[model samples]
Target chain A: MHKLYMGNRQKAPGQQFITPSSHSVQFYEDPEVFLEQLAGFAGAAVGAGGCYLVLATAEHRCSLQQRLARRAIDLRMAAAGNRFIALDAREVLTTFMVEGWPNRERFFASLEPQLLRARSARLRPDAPLSAFGEMVALLWEDGHREAAVHLEQLWNELLGRHSFSLLCAYPIACFAHDSRDDLFARVCREHTEVMPTEGYTALQSDAERLRLVSTLQQEAAVVRAVVEERERAIAQRRHAEEKLWRSEEFVRRIIESGVDCVMILDPQGRLEYISPSGQQALEISNLSNFLGRSWVEFWKDEDRPRVEAALAAARAGGIGSFQGDCSTPQGTRKFWDERITPVRGNDGQVEQLIAVARDLTELRQAQQIAVQAEKLAAAGRMAATIAHEINNPLEAVTNFIYLARTTPDMPEEAARHLEVADRELTRVAQIAQKTLGFYRDTSKDKWLHVRELVEDVLLIYERKMRNKQITAEVSVDPELRIYFKQGELRQVLSNLLVNAIDACASGGRIWLRAHASTDWSEGGEDGVRFTIADNGAGMSPEVQKRIFVPFFTTKANVGTGIGLWVSKSLLEQHGGSLRFRSRQGSPSGTVMSFFVPGNANLQVHELPRSA
Target chain B: MAFLSRLLAARAPAREAFPSFSDGPPVSAVRRPHVLVVDDETLIADSVAAILNRNGYDAVARYSGLAAIEYLEKKRPDIVVTDVMLPDLDGVHVALTVRKVLPQTRVVLFSGHVSTTQLLELNSAAANSFELLSKPVHPAQLLKALQPAD
Candidate 1:
């Protein structure tokens, strides 16, 4: 049978200076593999009638027992026959140590009993017994290099007398750096045979194994250096990718969450990237609706030229901005304050345009209201001066009327007419004063006298009627009253009166009448109805049909076309209505009537008109 | 014109409606309290002066604050009623001038403008005793303000 020779010399029985049969093997092997190999060596020696001694930790001892059992060797029977001796290396080392240092005599005393029992159990066996020691490995792991070497030397000395083949193992982690090379060389020199690492052990010849191990070790060092550099490169790439993703995510979040419509347009004004807000501002379902579409298509036809000009400016590497009326998907008009800024490429050419559009619809409406208010302010200022001027003359005329009435010999009827004139002039003064305070919108309602309101309107028309030789007649149900906004009611009455006057020809007759009508309010309360009828050229059927429509005028530029429309609107706002009947041509006339509910302006419900 | 005078005569019985002027010197001459009324509009100034004169105060009219101040240099009026906004000097400036020249002179500033209150505030520091009236000035309120104890 071919035997394993792990070292330079084969083991011989009882040599004088050194054990010819003992081979000192220094190996770097896993503890289990070491155990199995140890078991093989130990079991072979025991089978040859040589005693086996093992000094290892209990874990390795059990592993060795299992391996020996797997090899068909009964380690327990061998121990009972005194052919095998197993001891914990730590316990054995404790017995030999004197104050943390190994004592030679103590080391000899500790092992001699185990060694003698193992040897006495066999005839100077056919072959020397094999022993395995891990105490040096334990010492090396504990960072005591000198003590580990001393233990190895002790094992070598024991080899002289015991004639045992020795196997020793240290974990590969024991000498991990170049600084431990001295200790490494000393450990190798102490052994008769130093086994290469696991990689080169399969080689057939020792010289070839040495050469291949040297080459493989050098190649492994180069491969490790290259692998470390590659790992650093991969780490750097991952870090850069993470940073780029974070920056893109940050910008994406800002653009998506922004209040304005942020969009990126190619230099040709085609939409490239439309932010979430852009889709919302344009009322599109998603960016897909706008992406790759011409941005000018979103603008109103009238606004396209301006948008094209803005895009041209932006393409020229300049900023452009415009305010425009744009419609939503539902075709409702909206105003946008849009701006396009050029994004220049490295070549200094316009690469893209960043369009940020803000919805300015409400702002535009408010600005229109401000302009209207400014116009009203100017009109009010003019009215104030005009009222003041009118009041001055009205006062003088009042005083004149007062003096005329105080005349001793004036006709009684003339005096009576002068008194009426005075009262009407006072009303004129009141109306002028009302104009001065036109901005004051009073919420208070008053019990309105319908007849008195009609009389007031008639008084305003008295001069015009007389100039046109027209006859004005009035018939009223006495004390016809309605509760409402008095000023608005007066305006409705004035509108009807003027419309009747316009319908009348020269020398025509007109009648103004009022009475309490049926319940017409939301609460079904009684209302006051007033009627104005004129015998003159009346409205055509079509004219009467569209009379209340705003801007529907028959009198060419002479009429504002808003009087009837406004009168009807105002009446509706006051919880009332204006309706009429008319016949066209000779002997034909128009009868216009309006009703004010008794409880008008008092209800909590909204009026038809917001104002 | 005759009817206007007749109308004035028609109110002869109510001559003592404002008796503050009678509380002054009671000589046989019946020395009336001289009032100076200033307004940019001649209608307002003359009408106010006429109304005051009808009530027994000897009132004169001036169209500008500077004219009122110029008139103040010659004769010391018992009261100066002026418009707050004048084409020349401001009414508050006239009041301050009155306070500087004649501390005893009473001032009444009347205007139909929103800036009247701001103008009054600017002069209220020195002329706190002056009266402010918004136009169009009612004759009764003017008469009552001229009462001695008022």
Candidate 2:
């Protein structure tokens, strides 16, 4: 019967070599000696030194030939103490050994005749390639009369290397092959072909063939178990590697997601990691240049020592932070908040340092704005105090002058002088009043007439008007009215009138027009609009732009620069607006318009009339 | 009627009967108290003094806190009103010094631009002993502050 080849070869325990004329007698009782001798013969035929054969019960041929060849090489290597490279029969069959050669013809002649005789013999009534066939081959070879004559014509055709196992049935003639013309062949036959039961006794005789075979089978099983164990170990290692990769990914995502710049440095201060926010914070174009560089190299020279100390302290587990100026392309920057935290490993060693930095540029700017506000508030308080001192006496002086002017039978010259004093006192009173208006806390509103307020403001300009020969034209639409604090509106009008009169040189026209303009400045509101225009030396374009700013004026000594500013402030307090327009040179003049919301009549307080 | 009226007329001054600049009514007797005025600038201090005088409580003018304190030693006013920015010791320190001597006297402090909160730890001894007033004080506002409790 043909020994079935399994999918994988079972490696032999160890190789035992017995060449012709060298150690041939030692294999006389062993069957593995026969297997090794046959393998050597096959190897010698193929011009190689190594071969492995696998035998099973002719049913398990599931593995590919390449897989079998790899199995064969592994088995041979193991038997040879992991030292030998085995030849592949499949490689030789597919390539050079089978291609257009004399060896192929000889090989086919030997195998075809043997295969054909076996088929013809199987046609007879006998177990196919069974022990009966082995007995018939031995009987025919031994000169047994009937068998020899009957098997003569088919004997040469039926001989094959695998069919040599038939001799086991004829235990006597098998000795002829073991002690044959070739000593190596004799030793192989004696070692593997001799049956185990055909010994002197059960225990004391040379009957160890079965036990040795069982030992070799157990060794092959142990080798297969080791291979399976290694495979499980490899799978476990792969799983652990995958877990490590995921953990690294999770940490990377957290660092990248941070909003503040996150940087990690190794214990030696070389940058190990830089988060995405670091690129945005530093405004760098490339992230590669930032990593694996000394942190001190990227820092400005002055900040290096400070950062280094912080890093050292953090690494030592004493918490520390660094605040230093960082120079950036936008400005000399202040990095007022930067923290360094040590990353410790399981062994309690400082593994790395992580730094987080937030930019505080807006915080500094907000502080500066608050400081400026405090200063302006202080200045306003001081101005209010000075205005208070001026207002009291100035009020008394106006009353005194008014009383003096009313005296009966006063001489014309003395009355004129009294009139001049009253006018100057009124002028000084206007100054005090305007100053108070500028500094006073605004509260309530009262109705005021545009025409009457204009007349009262023009009284202060009388001397200037007479000196300059300026044409003073007052045209007020009777319907025009305004709502505001009475004194505040008066101050606003006074500032505008004074500015207009001052803008004029000798013999310039001052036009005061009051009307209700719904279409003031194209798209404004329905309001009482007053325009004061002067044909004076008009302002340049530069001066016009800054005309309403505090402390901005063109007149050498006459303008306080704050008049227009204060005027705008007062007008705005009354829910009104002020605007200016001017022509530069030819027919040059300045025109300013104030638009007051026309809710004035509802807020009127009756003024006391003089008797 | 002739001698009696003459003696009465001699004793009585012009502005008010017993219109005394010296030895006027004790400040404690007056329901609404008067703060004696003291400043070197006569224009400023006298204006304040006149406003206080016209408001119907007595006001004695002095140039400095030391003089005001001397006047106060003779006549115990209900309250001592002084400028924080003074020719003598600063008003805050003067208030501190006055509290050491006359602990009963209520001190009303004034300055041009220094806010009360900025000057005094109001929750502490200052708030308990004194009050702050911002200058330049309007006469009506000052007189109203000086109006005594019932």
Candidate 3:
């Protein structure tokens, strides 16, 4: 039985010794030292009358042959005697490989015959048989580490059956990566003897070797600590970058979906970046055209000073805000509530400015409408008070007129004058009643003849028409009637007729037409449509578009501006509509038409009870 | 009925003899319809009463709804024409009192305030019980409204 060399030992120069049936593994860095050891092992076996079998790469085979020749071993005589056998490690690997793993049956089938021949050819039957293999190293290099380890076990199995010693060599560079300490220990555990790399093995004494190993171990510990610290710093930096990206994405999403226009400007008040919503709000399709342009250029001339002041304040690292009116790129007038704030860098210096603008056009319109409605309410109340105060005196005057007209033997001319006075007083009473109609609960609808209603409204405007020398043509069917709130309809007719009379020049003609028709636009309801047309200077297209907009008026001094808007609303309240068409030119005229439903019982209830 | 008859009989001859202003007389032989005209405006009440008197009725004038009610307490009239908006009490309240005091007497309400007239008309029971008229009422319309309903 051969004794096992579990620990590493130093050997004299050129002295080679290996016991039969020994399985040894060497992890090597330099090829020269490995080859020297290989030559010693092969030459000692051949010179001691033992057979040597070599399974190595072609390059190693050539080098081994050269080293054996220099050691004075007759490789040709050894081969002729069948005591030195050489085989390519790759070719030998395929003969026993089964799907990248060593197959025991095939391994023995291919190699046991060669082993038997080498043992029988030994000059003495008791001489040692030694085999060297590099197939496992080739497998390890090819990344088949499990196969290499399995093949090492297979070689040990072969050594148990054959009376030969096996030596396996692997390049130490293959195990240089971290976490490979277990694999290295595992490879060392598989052999009866383990040879360290040449860095340790080449030393001539144990004390020198121990000293080098102690220094290498100390340096390795320092490198391990430093690598761990660097890895931690790299991980922290990556985490911070991910958090920053998430925060940027959150802000980007908010800016993209917000309704307000948001912009970033440079210190010179030039636009640098604008949010997606900002581009849409400003009616801009391409931001490239506006980029680097002065922000104050977007405001109206009147509002430029305010915008510039706000920018200057922001540049001074303070917030500024103002409300101003401007037009968009598409030329839509807008009222904006704008604010500008400075963005500061780590050095506490103003780096950029952020401007936000909120549109307030609709809010301003609502406020104006509320004010107008309150004014109208107050006017109605004043009319009610005046009518109440005047009616009592008017009644007394009518009585006096009646008593005077019936005076005994009064002159015929004086009586006739009193009759006229009585008629005019009746008109005054009618005016008071009409004014009071605005304050009264006139929500109750009544069936009224179209002709009578038309004639009554015409009588109120008769004096104005007569003063202008304007002739009115009336064509209304006396029998045609409508169910409506009388006050609201009278107001609508009065407003339109007044507009028509105002539009007519001296001696201009006004046409008032009423016809029984079906309102196709309003679900085919039967109704009477009245058209009032005048031959006067007509409105422009821009004026026509805003004719029904509240507080939009062409008449600067006299127009209340709410007449057409209120008229339209009044018509719509009873399931009706008002529309007009106008043309400008020498034969210019305006035709304003309105429809009143024949039966508005359902709609009347929806009206407010007060007016 | 007795008080109205006494009022008409006492004022008939004196109204014809004077042809203008007449004091309250004690008694009369001929019967005439007695009318009470109430208005806060004295001219309106006096003129309306004069017109009613000229039109073959014995009429008296009061400048307030409370004064008209005070007059009604002493004597009953065939008709009471009261302005709806008055100083102390509205024509509606006076009419209600007239109905309570003299169930047989007719009540007529007139007002320049259209809203007051509307309120009376919307009061379903009052609308049925009392006749409402808009003011600046012609003397003829007022006389016609004062006429007893068929």
Candidate 4:
């Protein structure tokens, strides 16, 4: 049978006797049994006149005192004689621990003197010293397994240096929930001896001791199973924490890198969190510059009411939106479209609002530009319709003038006044046409004899001329054909002829003549030149010089102020020119002449005059 | 040349009549031939009527077909001169109405739009029922068309 390694030796000094110099660990299920075992080991050493030190939990200390007194061992006397020492394991741990780990310097500095004195005290000359510590077990029970093992190694060193027998104990219930093979093996290797709580004491029979040892071994197997389950649970928790951290990191990156501002506001509309991009979008250096401020204050004064209303809606757990201009820290005003959504708490009450503000300044400007362009296009369209509408009134006015002129036996001055009025009224038609499209007149061009066009103008003014008994004569060959925009040149000719007729006095004569001219000094090209000569009035040099200027009209209420200027422009466009010669005297007359250049591009290349 | 002399000879009385058509002194009580002028434009209709009045025709101006129909209820005129595009029931319909009611009321359809005149001409049957004149028709052309071929 194996002898129990109890620390109750009586080895005499200077004798060749073997002493217990190994440490032990005891596992106990019942507190009473642990106390009894502790008392048995320490009390036996004291009875043999040896010293035994005990560092244990307070409950164990009190239980040991009771059991020791029950066994008739006088603790007070043993303490007085320095044969036994008891300490609270937690208090001693603080004295040796430095920043949650047992420090060698602190442990030695605090307890080395006491340990030396305990070893040196020889209550009996032949006695041996022993101690039982529960500090390592206290650390292991609190989940500081590594620290507990380190402390066990420290205890083994102390035992080696002090020649004392060492014993340690942990509650069996602690290891039942956690059994680590590596930790158990490391602790056992650090100690010189390890044993069950009951194995350290002298029991009656070998069979009884074997049964208790077998029971301890069965408890160890159950502890190993628990430790395996604990390891699996720890690994899963680690993996889940890593995944959660990665997801949080991904969300942070998205918000930080976005161009828009993302913010969170409390239910009361106070700003809470501003994303990294939010500060950049706002052009603020720190998020604190915006956080804790009323969210509505971010908007301009005119838009504050809208922001406040949106916040109120969001607070009620509803979605809300606002768009308006606000000045940014960059010193520019920008339009932002903000969408706010309520975030609910677990109890389904609105806890916060999530706001995403997108900068829409450029988009709004582009839309405004597009609207202006559309308005301009619409105005262009309206001009054409307006021209058509104005023509109706113009036609009526022209008819009214015709009626007034045909009223017959009118006075000479009245007849002359009506002629100027008729000339100016034609200017209104030109303006209406130009407003619709300046190019509208040139759309239809045709070749016509100058004499035919002159006759047509004569027919138009026949009633006006005859009302004043004015004589008009046309002298042109039937072959004076001109390639031109028939309507535009006709208008030009009509304007000149009307001016000529307006210049003629009552019973005055006006002549309309056309001939082909080749005057090289006058930009001579082979083109038809038409002349209109009136024998009534002639302008002075000053009047002639400014006549081509726009809005220069001699007849105040009657002149169009644009007729001569428009006529000159039309003549220039057709590679033609309007030249005049006038003399102010008796039989004074002004002869206005227009030359149409020989046709180049203007000559129609189509099949001519299909018979 | 003969049409010119005939129109001038017919209009010789207006040359001697006075200062203006509207402000002229009162003339003989022999009520000349009555004419009705219909145009959406008030000025055009009234001015045309005044012109006819000066030319010895007693003319009335109506701005719409309804007004012309009302005027026709009291008297059937020698002619009905209506703008082709009136505010209510354009000239063709007005001409049809006038002809249906007063078979002797000669209808003249005048329009400033060439397309309207052409469209009317395309309907040869409808064209034959009325005399067509394009605006701005001179008072002489209107008087000549109204003349009994002298």
Model 4 chain B scores worst on lDDT over the 10 consecutive residues at: B3-12
Question: TM-score of the second chain in each model?
Answer: 0.82, 0.66, 0.76, 0.75
C-alpha local distance difference test of each model = 0.73, 0.55, 0.82, 0.74
**Interface root mean square deviation for model 2, in Å?**
9.9
| Models sorted by TM-score, best on top | 3, 1, 4, 2
Better of 3 and 4 by DockQ: 3
Runs in model 3 deviating more than 4 A are A1-224, A285-289, A293-312, A442-459, A469-492, A505-538, A566-579, A585-588, A591-611, B1-30, B125-129
Predicted candidate 2 versus true structure: per-residue lDDT over A1-611, tens digit per residue? 21111211132312222221111111124333333433433233222332222221112112222343443533333334311223232332223222322143444553344334433433232212311122222333443424322332232233333332112223333444332134323323333233332231133323354565577589768966876687779899998988999899988887787767788889888888767876676776676866788876767787888888888898898766877767553454556567989889999999988888776655765565456557656766666676556644554344334333433455788779978886776566565444443435334565556677777677656777889888899997543456666666777787888888888988888999887666345355566778999998888898988888655678757665677887787778656789888997798999999877665333322222221
Error of 2 at A130 (Å): 22
By summed lDDT, which 10 consecutive residues of candidate 1 chain A come out lowest?
Answer: A602-611
* Candidate 1, B29-118: lDDT as tens digits: 566679998888775676666666666778899998878888999999999988787889988889889988988988888766655665
For candidate 2, write residues B1-150 as lDDT tens digits: 453223212211124312344567754454444466655554455555544544455556676777777777787766666776666756676677667777776677765532344467553544554666555444445656765544
lDDT of 3 by residue, A232-267 (tens): 899999999999999999999888899988999988
Q: If both were scored by TM-score, which would come out higher, candidate 1 or candidate 4?
A: 1
- Model 4: colliding residue pairs: none
| Backbone clash count, each prediction separately | 4, 7, 1, 0
lDDT-based ranking: 3, 4, 1, 2
Q: Where does the lowest 10-residue lDDT sum fall in candidate 4 chain A?
A: A9-18
lDDT for each residue of candidate 4 in A1-611, tens digit (9 for 90 to 100): 22344433232322211264767676666777677766877777777777777788898888898888988899899887777788898999999898779999888776677676666664765676877888998999888888999998887777667677777887767665443356777776776555545444555567876886788789868876877788899999999999999999898898888988899989888999988777776777866667798888778899999998888888887888999887877776788999999999899999889999998977886676467557646876676457557767876777667666765676788878877886677655544544343223355556776677777677667777998788998888765667778767777887898888888889888898887665475565667778889997799998989888655788889885667777888889877888899888986999998887757423322323222
Candidate 3 positional error at A538, Å: 4.1
In the order shown, what is each candidate's alpha-carbon RMSD? 15.2, 20.1, 8.3, 21.1
True interface contacts reproduced, per candidate: 0.04, 0.00, 0.71, 0.24
